[model samples]
Target: MDIALINPFLAAAKHVLKTMAGVDVRPGKPFLKKDDLAKGDVSAIIGITGVASGSMALVFTEKCILGIVSSLLGESYPKINDDVRDAVGELTNMICGDGRRRLAADGFSLQAGVPTIVSGKDHSIRHFADGPRLAVPFETDHGAFMVEVAFGKPH
Candidate 1:
């Protein structure tokens, strides 16, 4: 994976967590996984298209998703609701927006598409393009989560 692309993702994740959730996050050692990249059974996946073609996914366990929603709302989210799902979708959107901006600054202009939330167990997301897919793990006070990015030039 290009450090250029991966660095922005790490930065965006850190920035989003701190600004939106009031949580400090540290990135873990990043590695590539060809296996299904989805987390647990449910994942909130969002894609960005334009000057660049790729997708970004926010994968979390049920508990982790609720914790994130609670932190963002400054209230306890004991159970997942429409508000919680919307919050997760919007949060992923922001991360993708930040990433698009960073990429543009680096001479890669892009536009983000709508984020889709997928819920299921043992389901994996597949990116079948001939480009690098980076999986970055982040640790926060609430828990750990992952951000996955995959991109390549159009054939």
Candidate 2:
């Protein structure tokens, strides 16, 4: 896997958590995983394509998601609802967008892909065997979350 492709995601995650969620996030070691899936309460994923092809997923527990969403929205959400889902989706999208721009500047052109939100316990996301997958774990003030990246052929 290309380390160049993973830097943007790390930068974007730090930026998004600090700017939007009002929380400082510290990234941990990056690891390569064959399957990156979690049995968690809340998981949001954003896929990007164009010059580059891949998907990025953010997964965390429901409590952690709610806390982050509440901080970003400046209100307390008692439970997970449509608003929470939308906020999470948008956050994931922003990270992807920022990552795309950074990667583009580095000579990799990427197009925006649709963002998807998934919630519940014990759910899993699997990627195709077309390319390498990287899993980056992060710790935020609210809780722990993970970012999963899958890269395909460059576009």
State how far residue 111 of model 2 sits from its true place (Å). 0.6
Q: How many pairs collide in each candidate, listed in order?
A: 2, 1
What's the TM-score of each model vs. the native?
0.87, 0.90
Which segments of model 2 are wrong by more than 4 Å? 153-155
Q: Tens-digit lDDT track for model 2 on 68-148?
A: 888888899888889988887898889988888889899998776677788776777765335787888887777788888
- Most accurate candidate by lDDT: 2
Give stretches of model 1 more than 4 Å off: 128-130, 153-155
Q: Which lDDT tens digits does candidate 1 get at residues 43-119?
A: 66676677667777877777777777787887887766778778878888888888777888999777777888766
- The per-model lDDT (C-alpha) reads 0.74, 0.79
